[model samples]
Target: MKVFGFAGYSGSGKTTLIERLIPLLRARGLRVSLIKHTHHGFDIDKPGKDSFRFREAGATEVLLAGGQRWALMHELRDEPEPTLDDQLARLAAVDLVLVEGFRTTPIPKIEIHRPAAGHPLLHDKFPNIVAIASDTPLDVQLPQLDLNDPGQIAMFILKSVDLA
Candidate 1:
C-alpha cells in the first residue's frame, strides 16, 4: 500500500486534517487505512467489560467481535514496542495508508503547522517531509498548503503518493 504520514506538534490540526481527507480519498474510489501512534497510554476496553477482565487477568491477546466490527488488543507486557513495519504488517491490504505521529519513521509526510501553536517547524529536523500544511504562510522552502482546505490537501496527498 502507498503510505503517507502527517507530522506536527499537538494542536496543529493533524487529526482534523486526516479525518477530513479520508472521505475525500474514499470518494475517489481508493481504499485507505490509518495508523495513529500515541505516546500516552490508552485503552479501548472499558472497566467491568469481559475484554477488560480478560486483559486484567493477564491474557496476552483478547479479541472482541460484534456484527459490525472486531478488534484485537495485544498486550505488549514486557516485550519491546513493535516497529512501524511490524504494525503495518497486521493491516489488510489497501490502496493507501495514512500514518499519524510516527515522526521519526522514514515515510513521506506532510508537516502540519499552525503559527499560533508557537512550535518550530519540524521538516528541518525530520527527513522526508514533502510539504507543509499551515494556517498561515511561512518562509519555508517546502510547498505550503492551506490547512483549512481539505480538498486541496487531499489532492496533494494523492499526488505525492502517485495515487492521483
Candidate 2:
C-alpha cells in the first residue's frame, strides 16, 4: 500500500484537509486508511464501561464488538509506545494510508500550512515533504497547492503516489 502523510503544526488545518480529501479519494475508487496522531492522552472507552473496567483491571487488550462494529484497544502499561510501522501493520490493506502526523518519519508528505497560524513551514526543514498546501503562496522550490481546493489536492496526491 502507498503511504502519504499530511504534516503540520497544531491548528494548521491538517485534519480539515484530510477530512475533505477522504471523500474525494474514495470517489475515485480508492480505499483509504487514516492514522491520526495526538499529543494528548486519549481514551475510546468511557469510565464505568465494561471495556474501561477491564482495561483498568489490568487487561492488556480488549476487543469490544457488536453486530456491525468492533474495536480493539490495547494498553501499553509498561511497554514503549508502538512505532508508526507497528500501527500500520494492524490496518487491513488499503490503496493508500493517509497519516496525519509523525512528522519525523521518512514517508513522503504534504505540509499543510496556514499562514494565519504564524508557524514556520515544515518543508523548510523536512526533506520528506514533497509538497505544500497553503492558503498563501510560498516561494519554495517544491510544489505549492491551494489549501482550499481539496479536489486538486486529492488529484495531486494520487499523481504524487503514482496511484492514479
Candidate 3:
C-alpha cells in the first residue's frame, strides 16, 4: 500500500488534521487505513468485559468475533514496542496508509505545526517531511497549508502520495 505520514510534537494538531483528511481521502475513492501511535497505554475494551477478563486471566491473545464486526487484542506484556513497519504489516489491505506518529521513521510525511505549542519542528530534524500543514505560515522552505483548511491539506496529501 502507498503510505503517507503525519508527525509533530504534542498539541501540534496531527490528530485533528488526520481526522479530517480521512473522509476527504475516502471521497476520492481510495481505501484509506490509519495507524496511530500512542505514547501511553490505552484500552478500547471495558475493564470488566469478558475479553478483558480473559486477558487478565493470562490469555496471550483474544479474538472477539460477532456477525458484524470483530476485535483482536494481543498482549505485548514484555515484548519490545512495535515499530511503524511492524504495525503497518498488520493491515489487511488498503490503497493508502496514513500514519499519525513515527516521526523518525523513513516514511515521507506532512508535519502539522502550531507555534503556540512551543515545540520545535520535526521536519527541521527529519527531512523526510515532504510538506507542512500549520495554523499559520512559517518562514521555512516547504509547501504550506492552512491547518483548518482540510480540503487543501487533503489535496496536498493526496498529491504528495501521488493519489491525486
Candidate 4:
C-alpha cells in the first residue's frame, strides 16, 4: 500500500486533520487504513476484562472478536518497541496507509504545524516532509496549506501521494 504520514508535536491538530481526510479520501473510492503511534503506554482492554486478565497472566497475544469487529493485542513484554515497518506489516492490505507519528522514520510526510503551539517547523530539518499545513502562513518555500481547510488539505494529500 502507498504510505503517507502526518507528524507534529502535541496540540498541532494532526489527529483532527486525519479524521477529516479519511472520509474525503474514501468518498473518492479509495480504501484507507491508519497506524497511529503514541508515546504513552496504552491499553484497549480494561482492567477486570477477560482479555486484560489473560494479558496479566502473561499471554503473548490476545484476540478479541465479535459480530461487528475484532482486534488483536500482542505483548512486547521486554521486547524492543516495534519499528514502523514492523507495525505496518500488521495491517491488512489497503490502497493507502495514513501514519501518524513515527516522525523519525524515512517516509513522505506532511508536517502539521501551529505557530501558537510554540513548536518549530519540522520540515526545515526533515527532508521527508514534503509539505506543511498551518493555521497561518509560513515563510518556507515548500507548499504551505491552510490548517483550517480540510478539503484543501485533503487535495494536497491526494496530490502528494499521487492519487489525484
Q: Which model scores highest in TM-score?
A: 1
Worst 10 residues of 1 by lDDT: 79-88
Q: What is the C-alpha lDDT of each candidate?
A: 0.94, 0.93, 0.88, 0.92
After superposing candidate 2 on the true structure, give the runs of residues whose Cα lies further than 4 Å from its correct spot.
none
Q: In angstroms, give how far residue 13 of model 2 lies from its true place.
A: 0.6
Where does model 1 exceed 4 Å of error?
none
Per-residue lDDT tens digits of candidate 3, residues 1-164? 99999988877778887888899889999999999988889988898999999999999999999999888899999999999888989998999999988888899999888988888877889989988888878988998889989999888777877889
lDDT (10s digit) by residue, model 1, range 4-68: 99999988999999999999999999999999999999999999998999999999999998999
* Backbone-clash count (model 1): 0
Across 1-164, the per-residue lDDT of candidate 2 in tens digits comes to 89999899998999999999999999999999999988889999999999999999999999998999899999989899888899899999999999998988889999998888888878878889999999999888999999999999999999989998
How does candidate 2 fare on TM-score?
Answer: 0.97
Residue 97, model 3: lDDT of 96
Give the range where candidate 2 is weakest over 10 consecutive residues by summed lDDT: 117-126
| Residue 157 in candidate 3, Cα distance off native in Å | 1.4
lDDT of model 2 at residue 27? 90
Q: Which structure is stronger by TM-score: 1 or 3? A: 1
